[model samples]
Target: MLTYCLNEYPSAHGFENGLRPQLTFICKAEGNEAAIPRVMHKHDERFELMFILAGTGIYNIDGRGYNVKRGDLLLFNAGVLHDENPHTSDDLLIFSCGVEQLKFEGLPLNYLTTRSQAAVMPSGHLYGEIRGIFEQIWQQVMSKKRYGAEIAHHLLSVLLLLCRNIWLENNPEYSSADSLLGQKIKTYIDNHYKDEIALKSITAALNMNQFYLAHVFKAWSGYSPKQYQTRRRIGEAQSLLLSTDLGVTEVANAVGYDNVNNFHRIFHNLVGIPPARYKKFWLTGHIKS
Candidate 1:
């Protein structure tokens, strides 16, 4: 996985020039896959969209499958499980790009994130046009010429906006709140999980039965409300660890963990390592991910 960077682009989240989370610039790209692989099971933190530049495959996203061919696009929202296997004995080439972390700005956040299937963007002629834009951006990133980063940033913006338009056009009935009640619960948790969140408080706030809330929330997202909240907290914690110099206890507290020990246990449980070690993994240049 490669993480692209543009230090002089406009940021969507008040990140000044040359910062992360700009209106979602390309954080990574996988250009050519001349050497074929039959099967791939992958997941990532970023919102990933893959344009099938060539070949055909059965693409699976979050358990739902779609038969995809050249000129098709497959979307895997941040952290969604996806797999691909081609029926033909040919190389499956793809141009995959991602945003390291999601901060909704120009794109429709809820619609993109809660997608249950690998969306198919079918436009054969338009595929060539989109690929041209990608090629220009790829050259800019690779060349690193004067204003290369800024130029690439603009090109990336165009690419994403075009893609978003295509995605929305392809699915006219796409709803940001696919599951209205469940989405509301998710939004509340995403915003308030940084503080104490009681399940009963959520139920009372929503004026719904606990069992019904659990059923819907679980159905919408695989996890129950509490589980989702914890996962969100941990996800925030990971972001903080990567982006800040705060200590483990402070990071834990920042993400709503009152007990440092419990936070440590949960972080380790969800992530394979402790907080300190996780940070070290980034610091040590072990991976560009």
Candidate 2:
């Protein structure tokens, strides 16, 4: 009898440590003759690293298609849209490991954000080492041995480190400061939207030139620092309006707009309505005529 383990597989919620990074591995055992359909899926805030140990398939990621074969390693970032379709009748043995809570670690955030899937080619000595590690992980899963989760996590970490080395070696011009700095800035703005945050304060904290930082940050992040900050603040205000009993003025102030009139104007300019009416529309899901 061919057994399949999908939803019944164990969850990795208990693997979180208080300080270090956490890795999760989920395995599936599907029959070789199964016809897997194509579907679109996205992860909310976690990155996925997938390896195809056996079988032939085609994967569509970020609107680009890749012809995948055995011994192919793929990396995908958070919020990316991807799908998989098996082209052959052979049951696909796949390993999908998710890495969460990633720190800067001297790598650019753009490395994670860019939605390009490159196959890790094994050419030199590093190729064999990488392939061996993946094979060991695959074997552990197939054997259903004790402590497989722990073993898989350790292997996954080594895989990530190897990939990082390859990326740095290939792209010499990439900068952790230029790529990761903006993400740090955005994260800070998201958390502190309710407080008083200024360009000067941010530049000082980040130790970057004010004008140059703003230009490069906007160029890379697709939003000016101030614009991104305002958007986040308004988004928070909108959420509060719909979910809480807070008044318009309270919501505006809570999102860092001290002047109610200024908040009304900005809210109207962006949302096409004043704060009060916007809140009502959101609550009722009604469009004003």
Candidate 3:
């Protein structure tokens, strides 16, 4: 029998601390020329971050392909399906971790993933700075120092804040869109999907006809307004189910569903399994492609 451990970097000292970032260790991975994408895997609501110290690869994440290389950081939020296939010549080495919850400046972390933060970041001084933070985290974990977890958690938070700000500066919304109308509709949905939102209200606010709005949104998203909203709700529910100890009813209500049964039905239809089973798969490490 082979036993694995998330204690690879934990210090050799007995430390006791309660308050810290909700970070979970999945594994620290290194890839080489033989690395090939096998299957897309996900954890219901766990966010995975990879600090690419060395690599040249193409990452297929959530239906998009991103060309990545050394000094790049990749973030996979919640339940996104992702695959990483590196170039035959370039070796890939990374530090990966799972986070159940993270925050910066009172803003939510989900916005980073939704805005396509999975793409490879450009390399430069900031890259080195961020990489240094990753190294510090590794050092603290390996140092066997006092308050090792606390130091690592604080470093990780700073790294996240830097990454989020850089991404925001680099990728400006509403600047580049297939269609302005589509962009507007998407923005509205992304911002208010968790609320008691309606297409009628959106159309009225944008001063656009409901039919035209629906048509353009569908053309861009391949999902109707209601369908897209349902998808968003389910996605949030999955995140909550995995990250928190919330019951099915609580999860449903948190995602804005008044009827728990309806939420379960819709979740099963989209996920091809019941909500409870889906949560169980992640909890038991039985996730699939």
Candidate 4:
């Protein structure tokens, strides 16, 4: 077989809006009991792409639950809070990569797609191809050979382009007005989750009536304002537990729960496990069924 010259192949267009992706990290959890359940968390400056290599699981993304299985690719856009707590008996295995400085045309910085799009998409016919690409990137990064970073960077660009193509294929549609209002409500909650704010006061501050505010918000997002606030509080608590060495009571207080017992009850209700045990499983990497 003769080697073909670059001019012999078809021409290709470059990325739109000068998009350049920087790979921050690659994480793989396979056949490990400690890897099933990850505490809820968010990345302000990076987006994450995770592929379920084997097993079925449920992931909480942006205050919603998504059932995922093999051949599923999950996208966690920048600033989108998410968590994973698979069943104890399932053999869940996943490979994840974090990308920074990514922005498609008309999208926010570090965001792969709009918030309205579904975060989990079936890889379909591309599953094997995409999985191979991820494995190549992982191998390149782990080898530490010459030009490893450069190779991995190019591979990451390929992965992102594929993801964008798939997202485009999905053809997600949502009203801009509703998305904006939902964002405003979410922003208010994010800024004031520490406070004991009520729906009436939230509506007053936003200058909208309770009924309209509630309707629009619930329509735009699956959760009500109250439910969203509670999840936000618990998500922060999860982060604090994994990142800090503070006691459960201190974590509760930090997340705005004055009563320690109340904190435990709410945390258990939302997380399906006690706060202290959540931290322990994360640390030990094994869940005690």
Of candidate 3, the 10-residue stretch with the lowest lDDT total is 11-20
Q: Which digits, one per residue and each the tens of the lDDT, describe model 2 over residues 1-289?
A: 9998877885432222422334655444344433233233446566777666666766645433467776666666666545555554556676666677643343333134333324333224565676677677777766788997678667766677676656545534435555556556765766676777889988888787889878766765556778666666776676677779999889888889989888889777655567787766655655455
For model 3, the stretches where C-alpha displacement exceeds 4 angstroms are 1-20, 31-38, 88-90, 104-111, 115-118, 174-289
Give the worst 10-residue stretch by lDDT in candidate 4: 31-40
Put the candidates in TM-score order, highest first. Answer: 4, 1, 3, 2
Tens-place lDDT digits, model 4, residues 171-226:
58554887778878888987898899899989999999999998888776567888
Query: Which has the greatest lDDT?
Result: 4
lDDT of 3 at 63: 33
Candidate with best TM-score: 4
lDDT per residue, candidate 3, 1-289, as tens digits?
9987878765421111322346566344454423523223446566777776776766645434467777777777665645555664445567777776654333344324354333446645687787778778888888879999888888877776677666666754432343556657766875787788788999998998889888877765556777666776787788787789999999999989899999989887766667888877766645443
Off by over 4 Å in 4: 1-20, 30-40, 54-69, 83-89, 103-108, 142-150, 176-181, 206-220, 287-289
Question: Of 3 and 4, which scores higher on lDDT?
Answer: 4
TM-score of each: 0.56, 0.43, 0.50, 0.77
Error of 4 at 79 (Å): 2.4
